[model samples]
Target: MEKRVVFDGKLLPYALLMPQLLITIIFFYWPAAQAVWQSFFIQDAFGLTMQFVWFENYSVLFANPDYYRSMVTTLVFSCLVTFFSLSIALMFAVQADKHIKAAGAYKTFLMWPYAVAPAIAGVLWLFMFQPSLGLVAQAIRALGVDWNPQLNGGHAMTLVVMAATWKQISYNFLFFLAGLQSIPKSVIEAAAIDGARPARRFWTIIFPLLSPTTFFLLVVNIVYVFFDTFGIIDSVTGGGPAQATTTLVYKVFSDGRLGGDLGGSAAQSVILMILVIGLTAIQFRYIERKVQY
Candidate 1:
């Protein structure tokens, strides 16, 4: 027989959930509702007049070529950031998981970057890669490559991608390390006893067990690249070298706050929200199938 615990007091459960529910309503739902409502109307630059233009803002947004460019930029940026951040973090986690000296200090140093603010992280990278004065830029130029991110679109995109990847790696590393630690040592020992090499053991035994963690990190990294990378793009490139690094979220900021196209920005935000939801749903539906747990 299976044993079960029953909660006789229904109000207790509701009471426990109230705070979180309220917070979600206030922060997420309210803002989302506002964005949706505002998407249908156009606000003037002077804030003195408004026009009710249902779907016009969205139509104009869709027709804009730069918007499509931003979408492409966003897709590429998200893919690169997600791939490098997860893969490199996993690599580091694997190495750090070994019985090495000063392991605590090693992990502490690895995790320190996660505590840095995104804008601050971007600024730090910017200072290290600034074409005229940055240390990394100087070194790259010394290698005979024309290293000018300010004038080169490709270089600007690369810079933002590097900064974004660097910002996210520490977060992924923390989770990967936790997942590595959680795997039972007995199972690993059993695999080793079977004459399995270290790489074979990791790919065949360890990796399969880490699927759940990897899947979770994949979702988080996608979300991070789509939304959380705004600060990095802003502080580093301001979405430039001719809008080379202008991702969807950054475009939203550039349009609304900077360009003063509030309605169109809101529409972009709605579309972005929908796109992320669709991606997450697809991941959960298809990708989750491969997860061991």
Candidate 2:
């Protein structure tokens, strides 16, 4: 009973696919190829000179202690962001799924952060955690705790992680809410009739049904932490406080755009791209096995 669209002609199919093919080539493949090519070369301070030292840039990058530190920072940031964003969003979605009064307004408030730009989100958090004039920062200091993100590396990392996690929560909430709504109520009712507690029903029945959605969000959250958090980190901390919040993506921008190390930056970009691709592959290979559907 499955009907398929049959192409009338080969040329017509090719013509229809041309636009997407051109875009992928021009935007993705071309830049990736250019980065790979440039990673092997050394460009001087001026645009006039170029030295082709194969693998020297990558070798120097690996030897640099700052690069390894940035890697560690990125790993920690990604883990924290992914965990907090997904878990918090799931919690909110669960609450909002209930038939509470003014539920629409509550859901709307929770979802509003997704519409805000990442830079704007970071700035908003920065204003509240400014350490000097910030309301939250003042309250924290009043608690007899020294709170200064500007001078403390750990504080700076915490600030960026909070901003990034907040920015992503709304996105994850949307998906989790949708996943929850898609589950059959009859299944939950049956579980309840079987004397299953609310928490047990959620974990054993509802959550298993949502495995596909959870798996998809896991991949998306990882990618978001890797690349999309650049704006938040840049606007809020600018990878400051001794590079505590300097992720791989931020390092690429800082080293190339600000430090003017084009070759090294390209190498970093290449490595970052490879790392993300490998992580995604590993997730699909191993993690996906646990997903019910």
- lDDT of candidate 1 vs native? 0.94
Give each model a TM-score. Answer: 0.96, 0.96
lDDT of 1 by residue, 1-293 (tens): 99999999789999999999999999999999999999999997677888899999999988999999999999999999999999999999999999999999999999988988999999999999998889999999999999999989999988998988998899999999999999999999998999999999999989999999999999999999999989988999999989899999999999999999899999999999999999999999999998998
lDDT of each: 0.94, 0.93
- Candidate 2 lDDT, 1-293, residue by residue in tens: 99998878799889999999999999999999999998998896565778899999999999999999999999999999999999999999999999999999999999999999999999999999998889999999999989999889999989999999998999999999999999999999998999999999989998899899989999999999999999999999999988888899999999899988889999999999999999999999999999998
What global local distance difference test value does model 2 have?
0.93
Return model 1's CA RMSD, one decimal. Answer: 1.5
Ten contiguous residues with the weakest lDDT in model 1: 43-52
Worst 10 residues of 2 by lDDT: 42-51
